[model samples]
Target: MKKFLMLLLALLTVMVIAACTANEDAGEDPTDSEEPDTTEEGTNDDDEDATDDGTEEKVLRLNNGIEPSSLDPSIGFDAVSWDPLNNLMEGLTRLDQDSRAAEGVAESWDISDDGLTYTFHLREDVNWSNGDPVVAEDFVFAWKYMLDPETASPAAFLGYFIEGAEAFNSGEGSADDVNITAVDEKTLEVVLEAPTGFFLDLLTNPAFFPINHQVAQDNPNWHTEAESFVGNGPFKLESWEHDVEMVFTKNEHYWDADTVKLDKVHFAMVNDSNTQYQMFESGELDTASIPPELSDELIDGDNVFIGDYGGLEFYRFNITEEPFHNKNIRKAFAYAVNRADIAEYVVKNGVEPAYGFVSPGFTSPTGSDFRDENGDLVTFNPELAQQYLEDGMAEEGYNELPEIVLTYNTSDSNKAVAEALQSMFNEHLGVEVTLENQEWNVFAEAQQNLELQFSRSSFINDYSDPVNFLESFVTDSYMNRTGFSSAEYDELIEKGKSETDEEQRWEYLYEAERMLAEEMIAMPIRYYNTVVLEADGVSGILRHPVGYFDLKFADKN
Candidate 1:
């Protein structure tokens, strides 16, 4: 760990020096350039490759880790789908090069003084891949469909702030109660239940992306195949080979097509990190995630790029399952594992040991870090673990504890972490736990159905706020797979969302996190930090700390 830190410091120093040198050469202040040059064309004077027309065809190759679970914007909420979807289709707002919410389909918007209503005016020139003009009805239909109870979209909870959306999703109200309307052909009006400061930021999520109502009506499975997919973003899905690869070509009809630098973006569905690293080395992929086992060896590599990522790696205990049903037993298992060792020894990718659900990097109204404000709530303590196990056994009136299984998806890093956890449980609590692994799709379905006892999970922030992490545990949230419910916790989260006073809202969030830790609802192992290797001459790829990749402005030599 110490060696890794030193190397990171050296890399930062080199970057600073390079930035200063570039600024001096350009005779401009470093702070003046806060965002990258997204409007630049890919035509470089030093380019060597040329076609018959004497123009080079620019393409960017990447690995998606696995085939997207689904291409439907509302259904594909995980990272595997998000990265490609973010480029293939756009929402009302898109994350800019600086990771700030910027206009996409919406040319401009107006908000009422009460902050309850938002009126977005769509860009007149924005057209889908099929050359159909994008209209406000697309947004309205997509939003209502996402909130429809029959759709069963996992991301439905994200739209709860919309007036009557929660009720409609819970089957207590009709779609008319959703409070979204197409004021005109290009105007979309939405009313929120309460004043939300992060409404624009929330719209950056792919779940809020618009769907072409006409296309969907003509074919129900428009998003399943590239030929049928209709998108109004910088890129359009050109081809899709399930579980193999996908190809995206620039959308000539895009509103901002002139700003798109690359002609094609190719995604290879390779789940193994080491294999991806090898591909990147052999010039098959432009960027690849660093495998934990090779982190130390590659830390000083010139191609490596490390940045803060807002997410958490954790394990969820199904309260309805045996052994984990008791709160005491859950706490026993949580306290038995050493998170620091896992972050340092097992997943050595510059991640910080996590003691709270919210990853570090969020600032409160008081200008303090949310994680630092809430100190370590859970830690390794073998003695406390033993005591809690005994108390839980006594409470259950059992001479022996029931068998427990730690389930995870098939991945090299996940397997390593699961094995380390198994050893820790056996050593600290004298509990012999079994480990199981399954494919990504199968495991995701099982976890969602609460079929797994204790399973590995992760949460990436959809917005730049601490509440995004806290809201996942709400009793009615589809993301809440642990089967743990608490009226107080739910109320606290409600207050956090509805409370107007920033300070008081933060107070609610802090209290809710405390309650979660006190009950040991989930065992937090580490906070994520993105570590990837990018080949030379690849630039302008926007990797937002709280969001997915933005390849619209990316260029390759």
Candidate 2:
């Protein structure tokens, strides 16, 4: 598992290479933007917001793109919610600046020789934002709640490693059957079904965050409002204006409060990239994602930062629906997409074209990238695509393909990608694909219900291991929005989980990726990259390639 740190170094190298290439291509010195302008007359607005003792009040402003689907740790599994929840609450472990799992609420832990049981000792000094002491029961309650069949948490699959977790979530066992126990006020014990190499890394996900057991019992909607929300992390929910904005104040009662430098964090719900960039330029937002149209121009700026992001932008084909129900049809659609063209022209960020589900950077036991070893399984082949489409039509006994509609969440980037895909289908296979858009919350719910015939989707790694990516397609996995079920695929993933030999386990995962591509359950577009511009005088904000943002140590002048 220590090999996961190699991904951090690889991402750092990508950052440096992207920065230098952008500078060279533009023929402009990025340092020019770093120089201060002596012509400015008044002190910066940030300086005016000082404390009573004449000390500057440190605040970091950002844009969340859209209103989060929910603030409940178990429910909000997407990137928009993950960013805020990561700072507002913490799990047993947290990702540090080096992207390794470090101690957080748990001060120490003991693992059994068999590696199936873990005993964690929590910090006695840790307290929730409401001044309530954090205890072992909080974790017990939260994990049970997430796995309770009624909660219908999309992230419940992440906890399947725990003994009886899958049975409880699938309604085959009761909550009492689960193996988590609060051994004492400060100690928690958990038993796993098998030895998991990346178990600690999995705990860093927000889905593992502990909840205030008493507070949640009293108010079922505790996470929906600022007054009722209780967290034990570096920041506390100060105010929320629904879809407009949210403000977070530093939590004085946090165990690591002394190390936190920012006084507050302000997040705006701006869905448009162009408007977000305008806000950053006008001093309303401290950080913003670069707009695709302006990426070439702003990518060379001194304040711009680029890094590898561990995620994939892809489209899901509902196999239960007509036309797509045919395997040849799905393969035809996947091959028709020109991934390289979309990545360069539509995305405009320095992202690699994805030919496989798992992104690059996971180092195998024999020192090889999982993606490179698997090689390119899907590509742009117009002749093959047309032949497959005709074969599918013949198999379905249809003279013409059925009308297809592609749906995506409302956003400038999503719209651009959807349009590009529509054009590709028309040019390569002569299929006219209609496009539709919906808000994030509605679209996400619809996709989960398997209502969308074809739709846009994304997957960010919940853990550093390659198995984290391959397991999503297992039969009945919540992340498997596509109605794809294969007994052979399911067996491969199951064997990979319990296989202890690193080489043999990786072989299972590699075969799984090849099977997914051969079936073409989903179309891969590009691997994600972090392209953002930060305001001057801001630093120390950590963005892990495989995890969410860490603003605990961020500072603003």
Q: Across residues 379-423, which tens digit of lDDT does each residue of candidate 1 receive? A: 988899999999999999979988888998766567777877887
Model 2: residues >4 Å from true position, as ranges? 1-48
**Positional deviation of 188 in candidate 2, in angstroms?**
0.8
Give the TM-score of each candidate: 0.90, 0.91
Judged by whole-model lDDT over C-alpha atoms, candidate 1 comes out at: 0.81
**C-alpha lDDT values of all predictions:** 0.81, 0.81
